[model samples]
Target: MVDGTKKQSLTDNTIGALLMLNASKHGSEIALREKERGIWKETTWAEYAEEVVACAAGLEKIGVKPGKAVLILGDNRARLYGGMLAISMLGAFAMPAYPGATLDELKHFLGEVEIVAAIAEDQEQVDKILELKEAGAKGIDHIIYDEARGLGFYEIDGLMSWDHLIEVGTHDLNEAPGRRDEILHRSKPEDPAIFLHSSGTTGKPKGIVLSQKNVFAAAKNGHDAGAYGEAEEILAYLPMAWVGDYAITVAAALLYRFTVNVPERQETVVRDMREIAPTFYLAAPRSWDQMLTTIQVGMEDSTRLKKWLYHFFMDRAIASETRKLNGKSGGALEPLGRLLGELLVFGPIKDQFGMSRLKNAFTGGEAIGEDTFVFYRALGIKLRQFYGQTEISAISAMQSPNEVRLHTVGKPAPGVEVKIDDSGEILLRSDSVFAGYYNKPEASAEALEDGWLRTGDAGYLEENGQLVVLGRVSEVMYTAGGERYVPNYIENRLKFSPYIKDAAVVGAGLDELTAMVCVDFEAVGHWAEVNGVPYVSYSDLSQRDEVAALLHEAFQRVNKAVTEPLRLQRFVSLPKEFDPDDGEITRTRKLRRKVVQERYADVIAALYDGSKEVHVSAQVTYETGEVGKVERSLPIREV
Candidate 1:
């Protein structure tokens, strides 16, 4: 970690100044790209500067000023970045709300701060604000929209198109050419630059206040660490509200002068990724799991010879990669096996997943299964994990390739100090620590004690300085017999099976542990087809004797490897997957343990009672805003 004095030295560079520096150094280089209608549109650094300047001027025309809060809700796009920078230029706080936020979540965010104006991505976002206004939400006086589709007829007051706002700013710029520059020059590094809302897996979301210096320092450390370079490109596919996107996509791009590519649509991201093939990449555990499932499912339909060849090389690659992860020279066969595997198996897999050019591939947000982690590494991808939180600008410890370990999140990041309390809670002291939570001084004080930020995560530092993060302190469960265990660790092991999409370990005060599992719809469905089993829906498939047999086999394998009191006694597959929209998980894809426990109380009781099956009639919401009941008698299987 850098000394405190060195950390303080970086507290002078505001995000706006960093963008200006990039513009000055590489004015003609492409700084951003957005895929539209299957084509990439580039924006030079000079164009980036001009767009931000115009956006700042436009926002000023709408009465947004220094100290005001400006909310941006959208997918990752060029305009969202411009809007954020424009807010920073005016010394206003840039708050990005998740595009998928529920109406209640949006209302809470709106009520947290004095949001004077907001820049939304399209008509859908505009309608959300309009609905809130109609429902008595106030404080937002202006709304600027980027996409005009399905919004041509809305005659709402204070609603303006992004193009029109830019035009207004251009008119103002024509009158006073240096007005935008003047505002940016007056900005201070200590001023609050952005407000990131926590994922709120535990409770209501807190508005995390991040100063310009904090954002810059975090990104600068990553830049200095050589995580990415000026020539490196990354896909901005993650949600814009996420702190990692702000640090990796916005601040890092400005500091390193790299290109940020925004995908056209979230559904099309994987296909577009194949075309862009970015050099730098980061994804949550769910995404990685989904990619692996896709590959496995696709292979199920391949010819017998092809399947034989894939398994042959895949086994060799795993053997070779396992040695590298353990910091050992493998058996003599490993070297040749890795060579043949890379030439025949790993190379093709990497190319198909659009990771052939990936340099700094990272997985975070949750502990990825060791099997999942090894699969990517075995396929010759530089997949590593990092440990972080929203309050620390999203980076605390990151994996370094040379000293990487599958079980650890590598060493602490540059300029970051990590310490574990007696309670095993990880504490971080860094220049990039957030200033405070908005309007929550008492909570802020509890989180930030002295110079350290209490991360709320239970973890320990290895002798070699790598950080091994367990699950959240509050989420770790203890049995009636006083045996303590981390649920996610066990759940991750179960989820390592390709058939399982998600699993919630339910033990707490119970005598033995059981899991509520959600099957991977595609993977399990294909398995049933290949095995000549017939099923109509998820509920039907989950109850099939054949499906239970498959899960029982997987559970028995996991149970055999389970150590001591944490062993799984039984598990039941749920008829439906956990949905964020249903409040079972957070928007960031984190399971809300309390909610899950309460929602599945019946299933838990049935499992403990040794019931053969529990009849369930649950309400489910469809994509078209219709609600329906799904009834089934899901089987409970004992390992």
Candidate 2:
């Protein structure tokens, strides 16, 4: 096992100390870039350090103390990042809540912990927090806002602007120069740096507390594994509340002195990513699937000549790649074919997705489809899979370039020890393991044993020492015929088709397996138009016989890979997508099995009772926060 405790100059220091060191060594280097009004704005390391110091000073003046929790709510913004660091500098815990969480969810999170102060992005977040406070939420003494638009007229207690906070801090620092040193020295390596929440797929989310040493250890492991290099550029577009974002963008960036680029808005991420062309990137499996669908749809709309060229070259390249992955040699003409394909098709596709400069790309949070994995590798992108959890600082294992495999998540990362229990649960031990669950000693005890953190995932090691992660142990289901299977494995395979978006497989204690599928409206709509099949709305198009036939062919392909008993016997194309606001999925896009099963009880019954169709009246939350219901008669198709 790799020793994580091997002394490095910055490994023992807190995040605040590392920021100071970067400022001292590379003061003039660009540390961050943000898009504003369609122009890129840069911030130097010295300026970044200065702002953090000012923000910390201001927070101190506003009664923020050691061991307190400060809430950060927003998208990826430079000022929000600065606020996180400032909170760390003052020896307080930086608690980042999901920006899209409803007010009731926000209230629940607040009730779980005591929040002393909050730094919000704009009027929307400010309004939510104020509403909660007005509803009797306690311990929130201060609320600071970044954007001033639409918030100027309201006069409320303990609400101030970010600029005003910085001004107050700047004056305080000028008055007492030694106060800066005092503030910096207050935090130790073992002090809690961040407070994060679990995904809550099973129940109420647990609060996880991670120390500075934990964050440093995790970042060191990734650095030693060659995940990134010094001076590399990365796009910070993931949710700020996610542990992966904090591990890479905050911890790893400070450790390696990398440059982070922030997009202007959530909708413009693809456009901004292409403009940035970052060297290192990470995205969830769903995001990758969507990008692949975009490429496929674009090709479908291309001219005849271009479409033929794309298919000919792409098919040949994918075949060659498959042979290489299977440990077989490609023919002599493979090199020439690859060169031509790169020049004719792959090069332009990479440019469109801003992957030309990406040297290291990773996908985590869920299992990615094999087709999706092979497609990117054939297109000349170094996309790999990683296995991790919030308790382990976001990553425990990641596939290296030379060790790429379709099933494994790669060998254990540096400093992580992995072993399987007798019952087949994966257990991990490392310095990066979190301290404990905040305010829940019982849950903490259940999660940790001795020094090893019980991951609650079932998996085994390959002969080559690579880790093969199955779905959660609790999610492993058995059919009435005594066949055991994991639903996610089947769901991922069905989702490989560009026309299919999300899926849920259910067969526990039943005679045969079945599925609830959500179709990709844009992809299927394009296919319909090209084939002379007319449609009007998503619901109308989903119930069409043509759509059912298309999905049947896709299911038959997936069924060929599994045993007869495990194959999907039936499936239904739902009229709408699973939404987070409706509580069907988490913010990270993980399915809440209990919630989904309960909400679709009638549909599941129909799938097994020999019914040709099921009527669904699903509740949907719109972008404007309006609640409504969609009624449709969805057809169930046999494989």
Candidate 3:
């Protein structure tokens, strides 16, 4: 285990104070940019700080005080970011909720803290807050909304517009010149700056409180380790509720003085990203997989000559990358061939994905598929994996440029110490580690022992100091034959095939393994069209005889790589995709194993009872907040 004592001095600066410092030192530098109506708008550091001061003063006028919590519901926007810093300026915790959270989920978060005010991004967010208030949620006395287009007609008692709030704040600030500096200095390093929650993959989400010190320490460590550099360009598109987004876009951006760019809308993220061509980027594995699928599908429709060139070049490039990853040198002509391929094929692909300027890109939150990892590297993108949790300010270990590996999550991050316990759980100690879970002494005690945070994940340190994560310790399972395995490992391999989007491996004490798969509707649908197959809907297309044959071939290929006892014996393609609103997956796309097993108990029993088909009538939630039932008879296939 590495010692945590070899560390730099911890700074006493809060996030609000950092903003003030940046404004004074780099007043003319662009701190933020956002697209609106096909135009890019910029905010300088000075303006950003000024806006935060106004927002804090306005919030104080609406009963905001130190120790009170403020709800921030929205997509990534300059005003939303300013409002978050403004809350910190007042020494209040900024509680950001996922924009797509269901009303019930929002209610749970609201019940956890004493929220005095809220900042809503648009009319949709405002409506959810109004519904909660109508249902008798207390402590929320003011609602400040950014967009006023669809909300001008609302005649609510505590509702206000973003512009009006700023106007009031400016007036209040001008009344007392000394108040600006006083508000900027209100927060200290020990004060809680933000409130986050666990992903809830195992159960209900737990509230986590992080102080300014924790956020800054984590950001500083990443900067010191060369994760990001000063004035780097970054695209802020991930859900703000996730720790990854907050750590990089807000904390790190402020600390390193990077430019944070926000997309115009969710649908225009790709176009905006291409326009920005950010220097650094990070995304979950699912997103990387989707991009890969897009490229593959696009190539399928290209000219015959283009398709041939793609295969010829991609094959050689992947081979060369494989050798390098294994610490081997390539042929003398390999560099020339790579240059030619880049000009003809790979270069265009990178430009299309807006990764041409991505000097550093990362994938985390779960294990990435091997093919996906190698494909990007072969295309000349520096895609690496990192392992982290929300409790450790979102990161603890990450792959350096020189030590990239397929199975390990690189070495411990700067100033962070890692060790394994007797039970094989990974333990981490860092200045960035959170104090405890909010209002849950028992859970906090179980998570934090001494100064080390119990990650609850099973992993080990390599001889060279790299960390290899197997899976969640609690998720390890044994078969009736006494063979041990982690379902996620096999599941990730299954999803390596573009045809399969999600999979669940089940066989805790059974004779053999089985899987329930969700086919990628777009990828499979395109394949069906090209192969002259007919389908009416996702449900009908998934169970087609020809599609079953295709999946069987893919499954056979995966089975060839595993031990005979661990090979999947039976599989079923579900009629629908896993939806977060349905409680099948978390917002970050992690599977809810307990929920899935409980809901599919009947199907699991049928798989072991020699049944050829299982009838399913499941309730699904729609994006419109409506619940409906889907009934289908899924045919079980043998590998």
Candidate 4:
């Protein structure tokens, strides 16, 4: 074993080098797995190293050079992961963009980075890049596609199949076998490793360049804090472009030798998760919320006896967790209740959600409902919240077992320093902090002051060192009467209700706050069926008087839990859900507040004008690229 000093010393090696080390240390160990055709395929560390080397040789032949950008567009699959490693092995940075990015967003990202080559998962992704090129997108010289099922006839220049690339590398290896070694040996920890774009909630997504050192540091900190070992298993089911995925799947897994599993497809994650039963999992609050929703809906449809037992035990678990939240040890029945709950209800539920083997589960990206947090912890799932941004390499603060608290984002991570600015903004400096934004020097300069990153999120540090993030500083609004409020805090409270899926609160300059809610379609639809409420589409269901009443009751519960000044007076179910495609929410599912406010300006006007209903012509975009308008009159209710 290494000494403490040696243990703390950061490695100067790049990820390619780390992969080589793992291959040398555990050549036979399974490093990766992917589900295809209902079969789970494994990749050993030795195979992983070989693939990276071959892909790197192939990429080198295609003009990928040191300091160049290689764009990777795909899901969490073996080829995509290997491509990322290959790009790094060549001393080139990998820029992973969302596979679901719109053509316009793709254009913007492609324009920002001088991408020399691109690796796409399938024809769908390749088509996006090809379309961009057809529109005169620049800098992209080569396109490498993995799944070539439907691209037999496409005559796109600079395009090559993945297997063909490997074959090309195999042929080139005979001529120049030392090329891969030379490239990897020259790569250093401080060299640029990946380019991750920000969520672009406030504006266009900015490229955040992270060095090998930044990713290594981030992974090391997480591993140290969580005591993650080689045995740790994780499902890389989230978007590959997300920084969180990069931190967990790419950085930490490579450094710590954890086995990372990829699902067959996005739709199959829930089912596939059970088979993997990942030891450590992380997802945004939205995903956790959806999981919770699934559980709640399942419970609703369960047999009477099962429902009764579930509620009984669940209440006890909630009580036990509540006591813990208040800093109490336990009540008289806490232990008995927890025991019975785990045996009767929580155990099977955890198994179903694929948390049976989960040592720790994290939810972040936004504030989760306190009820949701309590539910998971009460069920014996070790759910924790973490707070970070892309600029910080997707991690800065995370909750430990002892420091876990409801609604709090916990303390600074290991080797990370955090301070609350005089303006109530959080500032952080860490080994994992990214170097700067790519191509946007002015924005980067504004984001970093001295060495501290101005997190822009308004929050405070508790005496116990926990960080309480309260929405964005700019989003902290004041009423016309001068009472300040954070809309996100209130929105979280509203979202605690099972009927509410999402909500946007508006008050800012008004005397009383009003909200627009997106009803949980599955839950409310079931409720509608049970109550004999006739509704057709989402708009139709939202307009029903019974649905309005249900939402009003939910609003009342939220209002009762808050102060008088912060209570919402009027609320209306949105005629439609805030969709990413509609520009109402970001790709990260964060509400584009300015976009929402402007898009529903008429509804906001009606809410304040004492109108009983508001007529809206919602612009609906179909998957086929057809735009249609749906006109509806939504009722406005006073709580």
Candidate 5:
């Protein structure tokens, strides 16, 4: 129990220390599990404690010390978790970089952190690190290779073999049992335990330094709010690089003694999730989008009779949810609709989506269109939206049972005080608030003022006490007519169109809105075949006169949803999806508007002024750096 009277430090009940506590309390509990060689590889709490001690010793022998940082690059695995625990046990914080980061982003990020040591999962990651080091990185001394698979590229001085280092730690721990005690004693609650880099979608990344106190306590609070328990088995399927995943892996699982399940691989997540049937689930909006995609795509391939039946019941279920949305109970038709939907359609859908017995599921990271929320809710899945950021340990507000609402991010989470500033920015003061951004006092001070973290996100709390996050404060643009509108607001509305994969709304200074849309080629291809619309290549399909008219209709629907100035005035369907690799989207699939606008400035300019058809020759770089020109006539549409 933490006392409110005492100021806590990072090492206090830290990743290592918390594991030790759980191990001492329930030594035999399954702490971690992952698939290895077609079999379940699990580590019990007691065993994890022993390994953390060994791993910490190994890191110490290789020069990891308090206040130092160790970069971890890999997928979710038992050894990866152990490596992080080891880093934390050594009183050093762990920084998990997304393995998917671009070479330039990785170089700048790792260099910015000045990471002293790193644990790479495989040779590919090690090669990337070596490349960055060659390109000018400082203070990196150790590179612990987990896979040890083809390590020809690593320097001899920097290399640390995984098993050999583990043996060294084990040998030393056996020689001196008190060494574990000494290492544990060195940890304080305020010590920097982990560095979660900001998304950097908008600007340069800032490392969010989380103390052990902030994480563990926030997890404990979540337990009360969501009712997580020791018996609960959770799938750690999200990226470990994000604080959301780490909160579950380290904070909730370690501190509260919950079982953390790691999927065999990204591809097998659906199968693995069904096998695990996690009691509590957390996902970004895209995960649910993918889940919906899986069902929709699978249904698309099903027999017409089965697809018809599925839609028959699904439509009824949606109507029931719609009634509930209108403050009406699942009355007369609601129960009948639910009963029939569950019996025929939703049961199988939920079973496949692995939502059965899913006590609570969270979807955040962006505004989920209201329809998606209703679909999950009608299926007996309590899908919710939580509001927070990296600086607040990723949870400041969350929707609670039965109190949940559509199109809102819910009320302030327990023990947190939320206020809407006069500027309409969400203000927060909470125990879970992060200490600050690492070594960036000016930015940190700007973020935190008068005991409140000024969440630059704009939103308002409603009469019902639920929150409605509009969009980023910086993202909202005002028209020459003085009408303010958020592009994300328009984009969210656009994504609800099943054929539209993603959209980036443009037009800040001109008369009205415009957008660059990426059609769901796969979905549209199916639509075209079914509707007798002739199409071939993605570029060919996107440029079709019929396709342009369909997109125009979609744009008009969204345009009508907003005011005249806020309505989309013109648009151009992008021949390709917004991709992170190409810098049009962030790693998490959020549109990088600035990047997109800059890259497609000519096209955007042509959309409003010139004719609906324009020829473009784009210089594109391939993955291997081969450059080529892709020439095409991009089709534009006007409202």
Candidate 6:
């Protein structure tokens, strides 16, 4: 338990706390690497620090004072980390805006933030900011572009390239000898450090303001878990826009002297992961889900002999981990059986999934299937469910090695004390927790009560103190028959089927439950290809009768998983997949029911009614500047 204002760890400085250790120990080692044009470019620790110092000096030259809000927009790159550290060096807060933010949303964020200066990924982000200024946004007088690609047209001389700024910094260092100490002196233990926005799960984006004290406290849990250790190389492939990646790559990994590797793009993550074979890894539930899907797909094509061998080893892996979790070796079951399983199933499968070297793995963001949760645990990955929000500085409760339970999200982290309120809402009080939402004191007050943050999620603590998460309280619903249910639970059951990618179930005051389902395109398409089924596009395949029948079977299986009262009566394939850009899903990948309903109003209506097929006539804007109407009778069926 952390009491008083003092952090548990003896470390004081964020940069000096971590990166400095790396530089002195691995002076010439590659501290960070970013892939460009499919080639991984390396920068050593010394080089990285020099650049960070220079960038910090350049930021100071541009009138960025300590505690000023400095916004950053970028992909996973060295500059993003360097820029953040530079801002920290000045005691300024760093706010990272998602690179994927829409033009309107980006403009809104720019206007909302009282930015002293900004560092953009490249010319595209810079151009967008310039366009916003032209359209009359105020308070953005300075800009820094990391990559100088395609900036020739801009005559705005106020902007500077990151490399050029580095040169300017080297010359300025001699003029201000005690600059580092002065910057350090300005930093207080409780000063605001980083600002990150949640996916707006309930509404518009809100900035979570975390002080150095907040994140530093949370880092203790990660550190104690051995997430950061010597000779560990970690893939920083998840969105830099996300706090999960920021915590691992920029905060923990950087502080602990572990090498951080950045992939070129989303598509190259698998390759980058394999090449790195990172000792420690963390991913959202979706990433692990897709990884499981890929493995299952490969097994589907394997010969009977191979498939049997794979399952045999998978069994051994589970047995091994189970014994370990129970604190008993249980004396190896058939020494040769364990060895054979390791060679055939466990070893090869882990290597293929790029987790062979993984000492620990973590999954968060959303609830994973029970099977999905158990599969990794049984494989000895030490992968566990960690629960928290951006408001808690991202870690309140994290599952510890072999202390994991498939049904619950483990116990509270070291510094956190969690309690369930009258409504079964999880409340947390900790130093790791954020102070409040930026610029919304009332909203902050509403979220916080009696010094504890109300986590909106409904759940309870087991006798053993493990936290069992129910769905979000706001997402609960009632039937006209007086039954209460969380749609996420029912939908999760349906989605466990291989054929069903996701389901959106609705039955508030309705006679029976109905659903809109998104098919697993990869699984279904591959099945269709093998079955010799004909299809043109996604919508075409989704509307086919054969696919409808297959999904009907999926619903039947899902029905078997639940009681008759909870079973879905009617279901229809969604014409299109829900996407983050479409506003049907949040960036964190949680579904936005309101957005999905608004976009697919007819589909939900068709499911409820007795209609077998509903003709959908909707106008869609094309990439080539054309407006076209998609008019088709979408098939709807009842199981």
| Best by the TM-score measure | 3
Q: Per-residue lDDT tens digits of candidate 4, residues 325-363?
A: 888888676678777778889999989878899887898
Better of 2 and 3 by TM-score: 3
Clashes of 3: 0
Per-residue accuracy of model 1 over 399-470 as CA lDDT, tens digit each: 876677877888888889999999999999988998778899998998998989998888899888889987
How far off is residue 304 in model 1, in Å? 5.2
Runs of candidate 2 exceeding 4 Å displacement: 1-10, 303-305
| Residue 358, model 2: Cα distance from true site in angstroms | 0.9
Off by more than 4 A, model 3: 1-10
lDDT of 6: 0.75
Report every candidate's CA lDDT: 0.83, 0.88, 0.88, 0.84, 0.78, 0.75
Comparing 2 and 5 on lDDT, the stronger one: 2
- Candidate 3 per-residue lDDT, tens place, 370-458, comes to 78899999999989888889999987889998689998998888979999999999999998999999999999999999999999899
Clash pairs for candidate 5: 9-189, 9-190, 10-189, 10-190, 10-191, 11-188, 12-188, 12-189
For model 6, give the 10-residue run with minimal summed lDDT: 1-10
What's the TM-score of every candidate structure? 0.94, 0.96, 0.96, 0.95, 0.93, 0.90
* Alpha carbon lDDT at 392, candidate 6: 78
Task: In model 4, state the lDDT of residue 11.
Answer: 44
Q: Could you arrange the candidates by lDDT from highest to lowest?
A: 3, 2, 4, 1, 5, 6
lDDT of 6 by residue, 237-316 (tens): 77766888767776665655668888877788898888778888888766787788788779879999989887777766
lDDT of 3: 0.88
Collision pairs in model 3: none
**After superposing candidate 5, which stretches have Cα over 4 Å from the reference?**
1-12, 151-155, 333-337, 525-537, 619-621, 625-629
